[model samples]
Target: MLTPRWILLNRRKLGPITAVAGIVVLVIFLGSAFFSGPSQSQLDKQKSFTTALDNTFASRSFRFEVESKLLGENGFYSKVEGERVMPDKVHIKGTVLKTPVEFTQVNENTYMKDPFSGKWLTLKDIKLSQSELFITELNPLANFNFKDIPEIEMVGEEDLDEDKCYVYELKPNVVNAFLEEQFSDFYYKVWVDQKDVNIRQAIIKANRPESGNSGLDMKIRIWDYDRDLQIDAPVKASTTTQENVPY
Candidate 1:
């Protein structure tokens, strides 16, 4: 029993309401597209940063002096001093002090040299590829290739000591089968300096099933960096192990 006039009136009211709703939706979509994700310029910048890191790693070779403190289960502590030469060579000479055991890395090999016994005990190979190091070092920088990475998002900005930095959170990228198995359920959070595009901090949590160390967490902090020398050296590095014994 509705009149044509009533129908027209209802249509007019609905039209305006629908138009406003559509405008609101469009605004929201545009806002999310613009503000919620990285801009095109940012993506390009990331690609450039990644390429720079790749070139840096490929072209440069340098010496590194590293000092690290390893914390074991049940609150035991061991300090180590290491010197590494790039192009697949490292030498670490240090003592646990408490256990009086010496650890050393010659070439790509890692060993525990016993002072008491005067014998060298060879350990597992500390293997790292040039490409792997390139990717690992570069991925922290802003505007780096991130489409291939999953669950990786810009966390925020941070002030690391005196340096201002950008923080990013990285989770396992399942599409990469090698990475999926290698970094299962792991979170790699990196902090990169704004000015130099150098990584300031890297925290990694990994699962090692074959070694019986299922849950492993470690942090590497590059307290100082030299772009002139093209080295991202860690002034301080620390590792936490579930086992009470030093490996």
Candidate 2:
């Protein structure tokens, strides 16, 4: 019923339309490849950031601010600021129950400043490793290894302290051993500087039986990297040893 001429005409008519449809399909395939989900490269980026963070803190000093909000019947909160130097040295100052308190550790010696006496009390024979002072596994910036984490996901890009950062969501692989029982669950979103891979901020949500509300929320900010700190013993006149203080 159909002639050869008619067949040729139909094929010619379908050529452009078929080509357009093929192009549309190709575009979709490429789009999905580019934007579907976390690719291998994305995972590598997050790992790279974590590695860089570990390396950076190993040889550098930084300042940190910790803010905590207690949820429960008591509604308690606190903000603590501290600076740490590598090898050994940390200075932390905070207020508890409207009372100001501070402590400084240098090498094997630690000194606690009494709020009421206005004097520094020496706490002897204390050695704090970098891991303990920096909160290695508990903090986003200090944990160099993530072998425990089942997976980490890129949350997206955002701004922190006016700087652009790539945000990543992570959960700690916590194991119940000794004090670990107190730490129930941990969720963290870390913001790393897009330019230098430096950590700008970390939001940590934790569950602990120690809290009246059993919820612990903390935000840690790191800055002032590589800055020299002047940490010297308090004036002798203003300082007293625990044994020297009158009971």
Candidate 3:
């Protein structure tokens, strides 16, 4: 009788123990299933966004319109309007009237067509390079493979004027070393439209300690984007230079 009682008690304990163990296993399995991987839709969305940007940059010919304001060293502000047609090649013409002149990138070169002489003037290639223009004009979206730019973090959603947009911030990663050195301590803030993932605005800032200048800030606002034509022709772009030198 005593042996039978002991056996019955052990069986009773085993029943609850097995039940708790099973519950624990189920919880672990569910957690892993839910959180272990991204859903198919999430993966597809990322792929779609990347592909759209890629297509936008790969277009052969497009029209570009831009308005820019420059801050001069002598405490003067100048405004300019520019248009470019990249048909078989790139051609840009802008005039500040009396202040300064600006040009656009063509292939790996920078040239300005003189309004007076009706001749194209070749300028020394400086900041704007072919790769830089490609990334800047069409795809401000972070490319994980080409440039080790950090995975863009969608900070929040907001309405840029009337278009709904997602604001993303990009930081320097391993692939950004070249840019980091050239630009020197820079940050890019991009506004991408929610509807199409099209970039509507980009603000690029850099700290120039070498030149004893405070820094340089460039703001590019794209009012309209042509998706079918694969163009992001900025309606307005402003660049401000605030140097530390005596004003």
The TM-scores, one per candidate, come to 0.50, 0.71, 0.48
Instruction: Provide the clashing-pair count of each candidate structure.
Output: 2, 0, 0
Residue 28 in model 2: shift from native, Å? 10
lDDT of 2 by residue, 1-247 (tens): 5799899999999999999999999999999988877688887777866764665577467787777665666655767788777757777788644668677777766676778877777755543223343243223244333437665787789988788888888886654342255455677788887877777688877676666456767788887777886666455524344455221
| Model 2: CA > 4 A from native | 4-37, 74-76, 127-147, 174-179, 209-213, 237-247
**Candidate 1: lDDT of 107?**
49
Candidate with best TM-score: 2
Give the per-residue Cα lDDT of candidate 1 at 229: 34
Worst 10 residues of 3 by lDDT: 238-247
lDDT per model vs. reference: 0.48, 0.66, 0.49
Task: Give the winner by lDDT: 1 or 3.
Answer: 3
Candidate 1 is scored at a TM of 0.50
For candidate 3, list the clashing residue pairs, or say none.
Answer: none
lDDT of 1 at 210: 50
Please provide, for model 3 over 130-230, each residue's C-alpha lDDT reduced to its tens digit, 9 standing for 90 to 100: 44433233222222223545454556568987888767666544244334554455565667667766656666666555564545455655433432333
Total colliding residue pairs, candidate 3: 0
